[model samples]
Target: MKQILKTILLPLFLITALSLNNCATIFSGTSQDVEINAKPQGTTIIILGGTIGKIIRYGAKIQSFIDIFSEYLDEEDKKVLERYSFESLITAVILEVRGVVPVERSMSQEVAKVLAKIPRSYKVKVLNTFGMEEFALAPVKTELKTSGGYAVIGYMSGKKIVVKEINTRLNWTILWNVLNGFILLPIDVLTGAYKKLTPLELDMELNEPGEKLSDYQAQGPNQKILILVN
Candidate 1:
């Protein structure tokens, strides 16, 4: 019974930890948005970033399966498994999932069509510029939008993008970490807590240190620049 409890509780605890957006948001620096105001308001914005939460979840599932058969494994096999840890798995998965996801596609292919072309360079800019903030340390959600909706806004800096805040609502329960089936589902619906979307009014500056204006212009004219990220 004790071994069974350990098996069930360990995964449940990890899952619960995975669902905590506050903790994730605090660490995941990927929650910011970029906004640009050019003569043309609806120009296309392309963002390149990806999240790894799903991959991590999948890995945990695999590990759980392995744990189920652990008792039958030889000492050498057990040693091999012991060499790997959950935290390491999560880290590896995050690195693998981090990449580009186009947020908005270009509408027109004309010579003078409005386009805020965010080359891979600017993405690096934002990540490097704002990475030091405490909130940025949160685990990045692979999904573009969280349970609570996000918004874009203006700032004091000339051309800035920021992740103002993250508000997430979960059908949370203390037992969700342990129980399943009919019991857990109903409890979630009945006792779930709701969170209202709080406005994220962060003023993120895009100016990378030691870089001049020439660096910011990866593509397009000056007046037609805006940064819209997911």
Candidate 2:
């Protein structure tokens, strides 16, 4: 009886461990440890389902957001959500790119060109790649969803949050006060600046895979950002 019990428990434990290792966490609110899927590499993107806090943690010269976030989680009263960090969760889709050096300005420009083709309803930004001394991250293409709210969390890209509110009554009054209204939270969108968004005619695929450089079955770490979408 004891042997049978141990055998059952051992297999269950292995299954649980494998399951945990396969997927990223999903937080409930404004939080995450997301990585934009930008390359043929295996990068991870985590998402929550609410407001994306500030974008202070990432940009041109970030050293280590993981370290910072870890410290934040360690604080006495602070706690990381069961699924992800408080920075990313409300995302609809993630575009992970790979191949080129993360710091090349050309990389940024190329990414921008891709963004130009995305639907206006989708919130997009560049994910930074300055501190990754490790393997390239895996990236995924995205197709934004208009009817749902979104949040994005990933390595080096600034945080982005998009929601669907079809011109509410309060929004009407807010638009009447442009100057003061701009001071409120969602500056651009609240000021009617987002009304003129257009989608681009383009397609994004795995660069390495497209080039036939996928190394057959092997993956690399020099890939770009990871992606997450609703």
Candidate 3:
């Protein structure tokens, strides 16, 4: 009788605990949808640059692979691989210097490094630039990681707008982990379920040519500038 009860009760307890753990990961997820809209309604939104660290790391991995296999490759193949690696390194450095890609370090550290060299309010061009990856028209919805370190740029009527970065904030849903003895806090953090992207919805007004970038108000959690084309 005692053995039977132990078996049944232990399984029940394990099931209960497992079900309670990772509340945020189970409920809130690690990404959020962001909606963007512009006053003129048809502006193009461009997402530029990704985690620089990842790009650099990938390039390094490729270079290492090429070096290991070079004994079997022809001179032409070697030259092609070397050129690709060089271009990748240059691209990573360019994006990093331009503040379009975030370093692999902590956000605070990266921001501190950037602020030391550049003004806090400075903005960088996004459209017609390197590392431009994705694009959509205004009034569009897209999914972004809650970890939040990306850039967005807008283009319309031959004008361009630049948003330096997207930001993230603590997600209240992670607090639910307290009920589970914080057993899931690590999971939430690892999956980025502990935070949510801020300014999930952005609505900006498009100004005519000759308008100063400072004249526009930022609707998101970063420096924004409007670049007018003649």
From the highest TM-score down, the ranking of the candidates is: 3, 1, 2
Any idea what lDDT model 3 has?
Answer: 0.40
Top candidate (lDDT): 3
- 2 or 3, greater by TM-score: 3
lDDT of 1 by residue, 84-104 (tens): 432222222122223311212
lDDT string, candidate 3, 11-128, tens digits:
3333233333211112355555567777667766655445432232233344543443445455655554443332222323234444554422212333223223432232132223
Instruction: Please give the CA lDDT of all the candidate structures.
Output: 0.27, 0.25, 0.40
By lDDT, highest first, what's the ranking?
A: 3, 1, 2
Give model 2's TM-score versus the native structure.
0.19
TM-scores of the models, in the given order? 0.22, 0.19, 0.34
**Candidate 3 at residue 101, lDDT?**
45
- What tens digits encode model 2's per-residue C-alpha lDDT throughout 34-129? 223432234333322222212222211112223332332333222222222222211211332343222222123332333234333332322322
- In model 1, the worst 10-residue window by lDDT is 106-115
